[model samples]
Target: MSDPAKEYKQLKEDFVSNLTGGSIGEINLVTAIVPVSVLLWSVLQKRHSFFKPYTVNAFGLDYLINVGTVLLSFTLYSSQPLLLNALLIVPALAFYLTPPDSPTSRKKPDVPPKAKSKHGATATPDALGALPLKPFLTTYRGSMIVATCIAILAVDFRLFPRRFAKVETWGTSLMDLGVGSFVFSAGIVAARPVLKERAAGAPASPLAPRLVRSLRHSLSLLVLGVIRTLSIKGLDYAEHVSEYGVHWNFFFTLGLLPPFVAAFQSALAIVPSYAALAVVLAGLYEAALDKTELGAFVLTAPRTDLLSMNKEGIFSFFGYLAIFLAGQGAGMYMLPRNISPRPGTTKGAQRKTLLLTMAAWSAAWAALYFFATSYDYGLGLSVSRRLANLPYVLWVAAFNTAQILACCIIDTVFFPESYKAVDVSAEEEAHRGATSRLLRSFNRNGLALFLLANLLTGAVNMTVATLDAAPILATGILVGYTFVLCSVAIVLDELDISIKL
Candidate 1:
């Protein structure tokens, strides 16, 4: 008979893809390959006439830079091996390639539409359709988030990233990148209440209306949480071991915390609200994990298993709430005030204001991160999602702030007129080019894509013996998986269907 312990160890090694040394190289290759494949598909679909030098050349440059970054990361793994960090080069390239008059640049081009629709019916003035050629900074962030989430899911299930790294070891393991991208994006998105309200064309909501909306959103989260929990249990996959080691998947925390976060923000100002929540939650987590009777009880009260998730799992939501609230704080600063295109301010002036704000906030958060981590490093309190302590909060906030700075810099280089084209009518958006269609596909149905990917992860795990697939085969499978998922989002976009609660 096989030794279960030995069998288990091998299973884990295969699952995380660290079975072979130097799995980082493989992971980078997969990341580059998938995006490049998608870009190629977009090119084929758009079919800009073969002689269209500008469009074709721009896309070619993008593809080359993307692939080159992956290879460079792989080759330099010994010196600077963080592939995700290396991938940041793509945005830099994108920003550099965006000339003042380029369609992809921040400056709105005066060029006429490629052509009117066959039916000549006006298309709706949809932000989703505008995502492609003129993606805003936030749009890029959002797209990367979904893409990263999908990539990690593919890796964890052993379809790709066949060489894996442990989550705790740090240095941009696939698991951390996946979870961090999701959580980080969640925080930023949570910060956008003003923008959301304005976009919906509702007059600034009173507290009551906002509360009602928050509650509804919270209810949706709970329902989705239940669905995820039951779905995992039903599939007999809850017990399937993961890096988290706890009863909770990231989704569980995602579901349980958003409601509390929403309720907390209903009264407090964005920054102070999350700050206070973070303080309270972190304190509770520290205290509960102490060596006292209460701590012991808290830790052991609900023993966790596949069948019955631990109550301790719920406590982790406290940390997640802090993270979410912090994200809301980010949104308040990053997004335009009142979302009315800042009347009387030219786009240049608006960009300057945003850049200055991001710079100052980035500096403040960096200081917070340094101080908090210096104090907590000895106590094992740095960047722990389970604790969601001050250091973790600062780190996430600082990292996000830095990314925002990058976005602002990119915007300045590219010239952001597309995002500022807020007053354009619906008919104008419909006649947009292929790039918008592709970007909007992921942007509009983000939640749906996430849900679909989760469902597909489970399905793949159940049907395939993924733990030992060859790296090439696994990469191909993952690329195909992503393409299909992205296609779903695109099709939904075309049909103007968004799965929202």
Candidate 2:
């Protein structure tokens, strides 16, 4: 009979939750039910097909699980951070331990018609050569990464699950914009090209058809966008405030631009070389004018809708757009499935690349750190949204991207081949062990661990003021709560809990 919002207020008094996309979040803001509903609907549509393998039903279930994990992570987030981190390690470990239901593990006749399934989204690679009319709707890595970013943004913006992170403007920018949104978005940038439409049987084009790629990207982001809005609604349930009209969600900007990408993809496809140069010029122009006192020169106006408008994402567009376009170009020429080891190559080139990326990132960071904190006028000015500060945005984007690329280089050095090798020397093994440990720290199972960490962190805050649970305890509960919550997630993820509710 008592109100939950009132109850939460009583418990903490000042919890900051700026939740984003709702379901899988727009796979973002909605409850676990939304993705299940979509997947079930898809399954129902195919049920009547005489040729519909019962296996397809299983794939639907997997989709449901993946989305469910997203849902679970947010639920855990509402509790604690450290607990959530611990909780995340479980499922990925289970996936590793489980006999990987390899692609060929079961044959058509052997798989119970109803039981055959796949874990990832429905990206059955296009057959040998022909381009599929519609690209795979889900399961594409790029779209998934994009969805992840939008979902997290939704979590930060729309919902007041735990508490808004109170940080110095710069610290807040670094934490929220830097590590959170920017880090995940970089993965999306790296993976974007992989999401493009590839014919079933043809030599893969350097770039996917722009329109198809854009639509695929946009549609996914849009669905996530709606969930983002819904998440805000949910946050209102717990913390009543009217943040509904604020339109600063970057997903909207991103979704809107895909059409633009599609429209221009074909034309620009011809002049591939100009793509990078154009983006660089545009970004510099946008940054200098909008991000500083000299912003007037670029003639870029900040957001000014009468009802509600944000100048962050779009106004600072050219900078990020440059990053994105540059990413696309890199995807076209740089990252690909086929990599060969040159005669003298044995981690030498990879190490060199990693070192260079570090050097660039470090140099950029020094310049940016000084410029970001010391400057009078910053990208912080918001015609659109405060969250999308241009200087902060570029600094984080460039830094994060550089870091990710460097990581990829290291990955290439160790992985030379995609699969794990049976025999290896101690030195190489030691190198891999360190990298693997680092990576496993944030791999997919990371969600479960993060949730668990949240709970433990909460419990710690309530009971003991270990250095770990200081201000976080400032909310409610204690480190003990953090421990228990994370314990649950770690157990669950490790078990690979298949329940889909």
Candidate 3:
């Protein structure tokens, strides 16, 4: 008889590669080990190239050095965090992009236009002509993120020093270096050839420099980039949380996205009725789940001290919300011509709005905290058994929804898409895009967040839960790491790191 467990294992392999030893921590370390090495190699070998300031490729060796060391430190710790308490700060590398093959190596092949129109094999700019080079540039963050993730998965070095001593574990690092880089790059740049190019009059290449694309294009591109990064991180993070036996809830997170996005779009839709309908769907699903034992199964998985670490407890109904919300926000951020090129936008109107929103969030939190103390508001979800509690879900959703609305508004008003020019024969636009930049940025930096979040969640579970210090340390390490992560992200942004992976 065929073993169901074997079939299940095969299916898992077919879909997602896991951490070593079937352990969450092992998986994290194994996946991270290779990425760290690649980053180190890239940093150690800093060389310049044609696309200097335009892409993540520009970070060169330093990108590897900084990111590599970080990954290595995280994965190395069985229970120890080397990155922060190192008392030893390694200098971040300084370098720029360089393709595997040098520009000089290419004598410039006579690249003929592949697309030939019937009019005497001539070319036209209307999706048939040569285009100008894209002037916009996405930071190299995406490349680093994907590359590192690939590296981690490829490599399987043990975080514990004892495990590292083994020969089998050693080879995993090299395997990761070889395979991870390719996959990571592929993930970030799966969409290069067919993206839109600018018309001939546009002197600059919009596609190459993503940020320079028009507002519509920019927003769309940004959303894609964000989705890619968040989705990857979200899934990965959920898996990590699952190690906690009860906290891992990516499905719960994902279930929330589709509806959130739908509801959000309803708000932005031509017909408000559509959005209202989406909300109805969201409510109905949760209600249905609430009415059934299935809902109970999702929220109230066997609460065991030992298994609780798995993080299996979640209202699956809300899992889709994250995806929906992220997608919806992206869609709205790509505004049509209605509010384009607004004047005095950078004058801080929205920034003030953001600040005000921040204050409002703080106040709401204080009130909620106080209310929870006085009245048992079921984990901040107003007196509900499951996620279907409308008041409970909306209370949290209010903030999430508002956050997206705010981001979309800001992006539309401030970060409009810029167009690129192309030659009918040989212009330099890589492709048309903008929204992807947000995602690309997210992708590149997503790993840092993922690692840090796991560490935090792990440590928190230890302290918060009745577990040993090991898990607590893991979670706390992440908590401490998060601050550093945010700062690094900000600095990377300042340094103009690539937003698109």
TM-score of each: 0.67, 0.43, 0.33
Report the alpha-carbon TM-score of model 1 versus the true structure.
0.67
Q: Candidate 2 clash total?
A: 96
Task: Please give, for residues 1-501, the per-residue lDDT of candidate 2 as tens digits.
Answer: 744434433322222233222211121222222232223222332222211232544433433333434433444454443344344344434433445334454333222112112453322222211111111111222223322422332233323342222232222322243233332343344333443433123444434564665667577556655665576566442321121124435445556655654444544556554234333444465455534543331122333572224434344444445445544543432332222335555434534553464456446643653454443744222211122334444444444444444444434443333222222222223222222111122233443343334334333334554334333443233223332333343345446562211
Q: Model 3: how far is 378 from its true place, Å? A: 7.2
lDDT of 1: 0.50
Listed per candidate, the RMSD to the true structure in angstroms reads: 9.1, 15.7, 16.9
What is candidate 1's lDDT per residue for 406-471, written digit by digit as tens? Answer: 545644443344444543442233223323344456666666677778778777777777777765
Angstrom error of the Cα, residue 36, model 1: value is 13
Which is better, 1 or 2, measured by TM-score?
1
User: Any idea what lDDT model 2 has?
Assistant: 0.36
Query: What is the lDDT for 448 in model 1?
Result: 65
TM for candidate 2 is 0.43
lDDT of 3: 0.35
- Candidate whose lDDT is highest: 1
